[model samples]
Target: MIEDMLRTPAAVQDAERHTAHNYHPLPVVISSAEGAWVTDVDGRRYLDCLAGYSALNFGHRHPALIAAAHAQLDKLTLTSRAFIHDQFADFCRALAALCGKELVLPMNTGAEAVETGIKVARKWGYQVKGVPAGQATIVVAEGNFHGRTTTIVSFSTDDDARADFGPYTPGFKIVPYGDLTALAEAVDETTVAVLLEPIQGEQGVVVPPAGYLPGVRQLCTERNVLFIADEIQSGLGRTGATFACELEGVVPDMYLLGKALGGGIVPVSAVAADADVLGVLRPGQHGSTFGGNPLACAVATEVVRLLATGEFQRRSTELGERLHAGLHALIGKGLVAVRGRGLWAGLDIDPALMSGREACERLMERGVLAKDTHGSTIRLAPPLTITAEEIDHAVAQLAAVLAG
Candidate 1:
């Protein structure tokens, strides 16, 4: 008891003393992780249900990714886009092929990719679509969580993310999510792009109504507005497919990809689009220093190869059914609603029973690590590599926590 008291507090206090309170992270301080599990500083093991917000879709320290990072570290790390590295072409070509796009502009984070997409769309609006200069408006949906950039958060519905961050950037139209008619009404001659998450991940894994994505695709096609799908959190096997748009048989004009693209190793993000759209940017218009570094490219290339096998997607589909079935059984017991696809889920815990934060804290005490969203919603995005037994274990823990 004395040792337990000493360890957790000291670690927590040291962390708090050094870091800014930008995030109210759970009390557990993870020391190491492997596959679907992580070990805290106290040496207690916990099943990682959040998977770094789907950034670790390949799981912690995957062998192929680690090997790639190590090999590249031994050879070369960065050349800063000024000169090309050997790992650059293959990574770009493979990722572009995976995305089925003519070009890929690599960046360092999801927000950068989103920013890149906006720039490219605006340029395309002026150069190709013949919209007036500096008047290109992009239509976005409500409850969107694209990124926390000054420009990206300009349209945020969340007060916490948006409040006091302005003078906000302009030229974005916000409409209700999953409302096709509102989206249609919002887009006009000045609209350059319609930016959306194919499945809203940060917004409690909310899936859009049936045919909404397809309808959006059709509308974008008919209206000459570029459809930019921000797949940073919903892509790369998180939704049981290469991209969530595939679930609706809809293909957007551009894919903003990140998270798992880095193989849980480094920050890697990119915007994938065909020639006509991406070609609008001349050489110096947009770029990043560490965007396509040698180390990042090597790790992400292996990540692409792993996805090419389709094994992870298959795993997510099969085990996701098992996961949903287990969570669905607990609906009336403690959970109120469950929504998601593949191995991703958002469980709305009965507010009367407990807040999502309290439930997650209890689950942490019982050897499971998950993240809470909003007031009563908790997101579960276990690695695609997780086993059925692990899924059952996590659900059992949830049940135990709720029963108390």
Candidate 2:
């Protein structure tokens, strides 16, 4: 307690003083982390349940990713889009194969991948789909947590992410998530693409109805529109599969990937699509300076390799069943509901007992780290590296917190 009072407060204050106050992070200041545990500055260790919002799906500084990064650092780090880099082609090939797509467009962040998808879809609409110029429309699901760029936020329904950010961009139609009828009504002749997160991670790890994704795919194909799945958080073995859409046997026209793509080491994102769709981009139309830099490609290449082995996916499937069983057992105790799949979960605390923020704060005090999304819903997305014993420990901590 003395160490926390003496050293931690100063460090926390210094951090708050220097940074923009956009994020409301928990009070603990983490200094180091390993597989599924992080040590705060005051020498207290906590089980990390959030896993950087699924960015650290492979856990902190995974050996393969670190080795790849270290080896590449010695050889090459950055070679902008101006010149061809050795690491670029391999990453693109590997990721494209993983997504069963013909081409891959590299980007630096999730938002960039999304923006790239939008541009490609619009271009494809005009050139290939024969849609009228400047009339391209993209249908998006409400409660999506796409990256907060000006254009991406334009179609957002979340007031917190949308308000005061205007004047907003247009060319998008919003539909209720998991409602095939609403989505169908939103799409028309001008619709070029339908973008959605297979499992809405930020909106409380909300999984849509069983047939909703398959229905979206059928509709997109029948309507001659591209279906884009934003798998930044729900992909790469997070949902007990390589991609959450695969859980429903749905393959989209494009995959917007990021977060774990960098192996949690660097910012890496990409858009995977067939040749005719991504080929719409000309040389100078869309590019990023550091999009497929050698370092990012080197690390992300290994990430693709790791997923190819299917070990993490297996772990997610088996451990996810256990995690869900544990959570489902606690439904009426303090949790009103539990939703999600694989290593990801969203627990809704009984609001009469406490808000999600308060429960997470209590979990923090009990040496477990989680995050709240809205109201009484808190999301848990532990790394796939977590063991069954660790899963039990985390569940036990939640039970104790609820009991108190």
Candidate 3:
């Protein structure tokens, strides 16, 4: 049994043989998962704390999402933007109502949603705001992780995601995150929008100052600029609220949503905004082949229905307190700091003890799976379905790992 546990499965070896070497995954090759736990090929059960970077927020193969997908599969799948599918209107209406927005443009990935937001903002500037055709600019914060598209990476501050990927796209200005003065100074006549994440998940789940989001909302309103909140990773109840911006009573002009929208079944993303802001685009101006496909819409509509109940958000809030409390108690023992909201947390381990990668490997060995971001920081985002006992078990494993 010990020898089998130490052996790397042939599946793990074959997986990386043909694929792009983009990701450095942990050693475990999972074969099955249910709720908060996944079983590797070796039959080892590990509590999943990463939750597919929050894409599995509803947990793996949730019954409702699965049933939706199964039902849609039997009826129809992709009709594309060329023809409307039966599931389209219901999804668009449900998601738009959830966002309190008049219109929604669905896409297949977070990157597509962000790209859609940028295009909409630029067109709105050119047509409505009367900015010059080629001169409209958008302001983005430093340390943002929007996506890896060529145009998106143009303004990225991360060297790894941005390096050698340019001749970059232009018309974006960078501002110090959470600094109202810096953000205000960065916005000018050419600025059409300010794109930001309410909580920077990839940047170790960084949350800004209390009033910063409201200040941005006000600044955008005053300057006639669109405030585009990139809530791909931070939204959908991961932050204890429907949207993290709701935590501070701030509402953005547009919302770029994805990640958990498909409920771990398929890729679903959307840009939500009022008709006035999203109205700038004509039919042929922009679209996607598989955006709002029947299967995606069906599954995502159920995801919206689940969120409508507020059960997941409530779970995140109550369970988050327990999770954070357990993490906070470990500070100064081996942890340097902890930051995040809801069931999401970013832990800064003592660099003197181990690198974040080493820490994650140790945790995996102890049956808890997590992902590390930068130098000594690791992120914890378990499914909202996780229970108090599960949260306690995860925290205890971390404490044991730290103690050793």
lDDT of 1: 0.95
Can you tell me which runs of candidate 2 are displaced by over 4 Å? 1-5
The whole-model lDDT of each prediction reads 0.95, 0.94, 0.95
- Looking at model 1, residue 327 earns an lDDT score of 97
Candidate 1 per-residue lDDT, tens place, 223-242, comes to 99999999999999998999
lDDT of 3 at 1: 69
RMSD of each: 0.8, 0.9, 1.1
lDDT of 3 at 190: 95
| TM-score for predicted model 1 compared with the true structure | 0.99
Model 3 reaches what TM-score against the true structure? 0.98
lDDT of 2 by residue, 192-231 (tens): 9999999999899999999999999999999999999999
